[model samples]
Target chain A: DVKVTQSSRYLVKRTGEKVFLECVQDMDHENMFWYRQDPGLGLRLIYFSYDVKMKEKGDIPEGYSVSREKKERFSLILESASTNQTSMYLCASSFHSLNQPQHFGDGTRLSIL
Target chain B: AQSVTQPDIHITVSEGASLELRCNYSYGATPYLFWYVQSPGQGLQLLLKYFSGDTLVQGIKGFEAEFKRSQSSFNLRKPSVHWSDAAEYFCAVDQAGTALIFGKGTTLSVSS
Candidate 1:
């Protein structure tokens, strides 16, 4: 089974703080993704990395960035954590196949105060 | 842009009852479609996927979805629903396996 691990299951941060959310995949898949889920909004992609040091912006990429220093690890960075940025964050990894399903980690529920 | 639409926001059904969740997608070519379920406080779980050939695909937890090219729909269905089946369901479209566009989820509530 493919395991995607999120560093934190629940997080609390102060407004304007720099927040880092880490994700690691055991399968060594080439693609990793960061998504923030909100009520009534489903899940919106924040960023995705197809390979090490390569990143692409998703629909809701404002105020957020990502790092992929290693193939198995992808990091989501909140440049300036705001109250609106607080949400459930999910990380996923998938093989390069066109129809392959993404494996997800247990999400991190972040709260900004 | 590739997009997915889940028409029903929420649905309630009794245990042992047949259940169906509607999902529609808009794409130019043959779209890679998926259905995912999320329990409260948990991440999304892939229920099933539709690529090509077979129109019906069986998924985990006794769930299945059918792909209808004429309707541009991939609707999830189960012969009998259990209380444990209560969760939020999302339909998504993949852009050649690179990016995904998900729909606002449908919340399922199973009664006793």
Candidate 2:
């Protein structure tokens, strides 16, 4: 079983505060992703890293950034948190192969006040 | 223009009854389809995926999905429903190893 762990299950922060959400995978998968899950919108990719120091922007990359410094960890950062940015953040990891499925962490529910 | 659509927003089914969730996609070429479920307060879990060769693909937790090329549909079905199966189901489409385009999602409600 693949284990993907998020740093926090729930978070709260004031507007304009910088926020960081972390994820770590145990399977040593080469691909890591960060997404925001919103009602009626499903999951929209924010950023994804194929390898260490390599990152790509997804459809909704505005106002968000990601870092992958090591093989097992991926982090999503919010430069200036806002009320609209409050969402459920999810992290997923997959093997390098395209046909493989992504394993997900439990998710972190972020609230910006 | 690649997109996935799940027409149903919410579904209510009795325990032990058969279940089916509809998923439709629009793409220029061959598409990889997948079904995922998310429990309350949790992330999405892959239920099944359809790549090629086999139109009917089985997945974890006794879920199966069938891909129909003519309709560009990959529908998920289960022989029996359990209470624990109550969750949000999403249908997604992607190219080989690309970012997935997901549907709005369908929420399943189970009755005792």
- Find the candidate with the highest TM-score and give its number: 1
| True lDDT of residue B86, candidate 1 | 96
In lDDT terms, how accurate is model 2?
A: 0.92
Instruction: TM-score each candidate.
Output: 0.98, 0.97
CA shift of B17, model 1, Å: 0.5
lDDT of 2 by residue, A24-93 (tens): 9999899999989999888899999899999999989999988899999999999999999999999999
- Candidate 2's displacement at residue B78, Å, is 1.1
Query: Best-fitting candidate, measured by DockQ?
Result: 1
CA error at residue B43 for candidate 2, angstroms: 1.2
Clashes of each: 0, 0
Per-residue lDDT for B3-96 in model 1, tens only? Answer: 8899999999999999999998999988999999999988889999989989999999999999999999999999999999999999999988
DockQ of each: 0.87, 0.75
